[model samples]
Target: MANFNEDGLKKKLDDLNMSQQSIQTVSLWLIHHKKHAHTVVNVWYRELITATDSRKLTFMYLANDVIQNSKKKGPEYNKEFGSKLGKVFEHLGALRLDEKSLRGLNRLLNVWEDRSVFDADHIKLFKKNLNKGHGKSKENNSRKRELGGKHDNPQSKKRRDSASDAIQPSTPESRLRRDSEGDLTQFAVSPQSSTPPSDPPEPEQLIEAIQELENAATSDALVREKIANLPDEVSDVNLLNKLQDLAAGRALCDQVEEALSMLEAYNKRLAEEMEARKAVARMLHDYIAFQKDLLAQAEETLEEHRQKQGKVKKVREELKAHLQNLPDISKLPSIRMGGLAPLPSAGDLFT
Candidate 1:
């Protein structure tokens, strides 16, 4: 379980990863404390705002997981997260993000749209704020680039040109395009297929199934009543002595035999029903265990993917830094024709 307080929530957020297990574990803890949904969501948003850019997307994923999963249990999480999502999206849009992060955010938006996680108007507003932020960021970047082009010294310009030649220009759009083409490919092959486990019987179906056995071991009401009212001679040997004649004694013996046969049949049926109930119990146990195994496997896969994504991000950053420091080819001196010694004629060189 997780605490709903700001510091406790912040610590959880700090350790969060993009894994499904990580997201679900935190989501369940929050849902368990859903009485404080409003306070929890506020803390989540506050932590999200201060989180590193990479972790920001993870936080969004956590919110998405929680909102959807907690819907069946209660509306608290959904409502709380819904109210804050607009601000979250606006903040995200304002940041100049790499292509991957932007795509991840857009994908989450699309899911929300498709699932009707929030009202259309609210979703539309979130999108509006997101796009507005992106536009603002792009405008600022464009202005900066324009100013740099105008004011750069010759050496700086040459270095810029050399860097550009060494690697593609690092415009936001270019980076997005590059990431879309290259980096995103790494995520295409999942560590494991996400196909869900076979569903267990619905609660209603299980209830009905169990209910069917309520009278399984018993005879019908009329039969039970008749058996209960059986003549005492069937069980009491002393009643045999009170018989009026051989005919009466024979009649009593016949009744006793009929009763004995019915009891034996009823006993057999009870045994069969007992076996059936035990089988059902065993099946239910196995079904639950199977589902648990599937859940564990899925969690393991998510953890692997999260670790791999982290490594990829680290490598991408290292590459970017390395590209920035490439030598300036534009500053290389030109070889003038006058400075070069004349080449010997082919015949003289051969001689």
Candidate 2:
């Protein structure tokens, strides 16, 4: 509140080494990103920044200011750095910006510093920055919780001790990471006790854990298994009727059609196999009948040839006997020479 508000900040920036052009440049940049500029240091901005807890961006801002004010070696170091410039960095550090947050602050710091800062003393300077205020409220608010539970600071010894107990020692190592600005920061220090009481769980997480335990305690394994198998984001019992109706519509039809298509494909394959089997059977039957006919014809022809052979042999024997009993050969030949005998051609056998 004393040295850091929008007007204070703007005035501080205005007094710096003003190259005539930089004044316009900085003004235009501020106007264009005015909201962002404000948010960087706005106390009201903490409302959006904080979670459900009323705790402002206390630790986070505090951390950032410390790192930036420390301004040792990282940023541009040629120009002299200043107290107001240091204050702006401190304000940001108070909001918990760490080494990671104010990376751009280095170059910007060079453009604004009145003196040079060192890299070796970065950690020490940061701790000093935390001791300074950033125009934000800094009061302990946990007395009500540990003591008489009121909106106001309940005057009680036990609550005071509990709140004090939460305060961690600021060491070189611990201080580097912390920005605990108000009340007590959760990640401040490890407790000396062997065991610590765990905080109460959120409603959603507790509900899930209770359901899991109930499932585990069930006697019927099948019921437990079914519950486990339940899909996430299921249709609630409240919407069961709607889901049932949807199933009855196109969804059910799609399932039936898919099943029928599979059955039809199977039937088609079965029919084709039956036709192929029948065709093969017909071909086999015809082939067997043809072979039987061929074998019968061969047997009949062989029998006929046998009979003809017998007749031919008998005729030859009679002719030989006739010749033997006939007159002289020259006389018989002259008598039979009246007609010539005809012969069959050799090519006629294959036909």
Candidate 3:
């Protein structure tokens, strides 16, 4: 089991060729298991078998294969993707150790034998790190020395003073603290202080944050940077380009949905305008010309009837006047009328 896990882990470490800090996550998990548990002396285990959730395992398990060296020495392109992979180390560093993690480690060690996925170089790298133990002891020691000891530690003097102060009478157990002046176990790191360093950040935190930063960078950093910096006016244009590519991808169904919504809105407006134009066309065809023709015919008929009626009415009125004047004329028969205008046309009478 140990061999199986080792082989796969080793391959990843070599492939990334990342800094020891990057691969150090898996190493740390292993060391935690190595020091604390009934660690098998032999082969490592399969990664899948031991993990309750593949995602959780992958979260802590996958190593950043891309070395953080200069771009020239490292991957030539897509540095963001490379960096994203490196972020896993930071995430692993952030995780708080617990019993569940121990189970994962046990599973990891149990399956390392049969699955020899790693090449020789990666396997060698793994051994180097694993054999070195967790970097804590060395780093802690360095810190202590840098404080005051000849070592790189920064707290040696204070630690020594505390040791002197805690001294008790010649009780059997008290003798250890009294005799062993620099016993770290007796140094009484607070329950809170027993935690890893806060300033440098844990390897897990580094992995998680770095991964997120890198994830935000995306697969193609070149195009991505442009999209990020695009002017507000051209922002939609950038999105349109992405939507076009996403359509090709077909996997980003959300883009398709958004495009569909825009198209639907356009279609709705077009349909409304088409209905309005159709109503206008109907108004022209049904009402305007019909009313004008009807009015014109009515005007001509009324004019013709009015002229004929007026002629008849004029003749009748003149006849009535003549009748009334006949008696008057009788009294004055000397008034002659032989040259009067003729009005005896038969066609003018009401037939």
Candidate 4:
């Protein structure tokens, strides 16, 4: 059970070279065990579905294996397995597998390919489900390519070339910031003011662009068109060269995502450091306050002792004064007072 954890699954995947065969076995176990299935899915399936396009193929293969194996398990178990497998397909569709991939799945799952297999609703749902799942990324990528082409236009190139020779060529830091913003700025049509705009956009404009991009980078046609027009003027020569190699398509998005990811990590580290410093500062503050309180208490106690000593001294002085006030016994006259008793009792009685 413990081995079913993320690390264990990760290690297993790594060990198996991310084999679909292994995933099928594990996923089957996860599906059959009704109580723990959701836990396992919550732990790993979401991540698994988002795996790369290649890994997606592996998942599709895994589904085929489940279908083939279901025959031996009888109709009730077969029905259950089919239902669970359908759920997985839904996940894949949500992840947006392409039509080609889905068609490949059709062949692999023996759907339209095998006459022996009864056509189920699940099978019928495949194409519809994939189209629904295909969602926005595909469109965004298409728009990005279109925009990348227009970006290298003669007019834009002229402007860039003119700007390239301008003083204060972009520093690496500024370039990185621009690339970072690129992720957030989706396509938009530039305002048709005849006047030539500044080579580098104003900071506020860049911020506005980023906000627009973040909001509509998904499927907005207008935003897509605007993003498509953005010049690929990243100042890092090496990175620019790489972007060029990727046909300047989705690679830019990848780089932007990467940069943002790194930035997030850096920000997280800074926050943690700040929190640690705050904790230390708090401890020092408490310690200093405690020391001040101790000093204050000690002074108060010392004053109390001094007051007691003063009272004792006053008593001593009074006692000395009273003793000194006593009159001298030698100087005083000696006073006599009275009387003797008789001793001869027997003789007195006879008389």
The TM-score values for the models, in the order shown, are 0.42, 0.20, 0.22, 0.27
For model 2, residues 211-260, the per-residue Cα lDDT tens digits are: 54442323346544654554332424443355456645466456546555
The whole-model C-alpha lDDT of candidate 3 against the native structure comes to 0.36
Best candidate according to TM-score:
1
> Following a full C-alpha superposition, what root-mean-square deviation does model 1 have from the true structure?
17.8
Candidate structures ordered by TM-score, highest first:
1, 4, 3, 2
Candidate 1 global lDDT: 0.64
lDDT of 3 at 300: 62
Q: Write the per-residue lDDT of candidate 3 for residues 1-351, one digit (tens) a residue.
A: 122255655353333212222333333333323322122112222332233332344333332111111122223222333333223223333444343342332222222211232334543443333323344443333333323324424465554443322211123343344223343323221212111111122345444544544333134455446445544433254454554555454644555565556556655655665665554455444333434443554476578679999999999999999988676644553424654556668887856
TM-score of 2: 0.20
Clashing pairs in 4: 147-228, 186-213, 186-227, 187-223, 187-226, 187-227, 188-226, 188-227
Clashing pairs in 1: none
lDDT of 1 by residue, 209-276 (tens): 67878768673676678789999889988777788889997898799889999889877888988887
**Better by lDDT, candidate 2 or 1:** 1
Residue 49 displacement (Å), model 2: 99
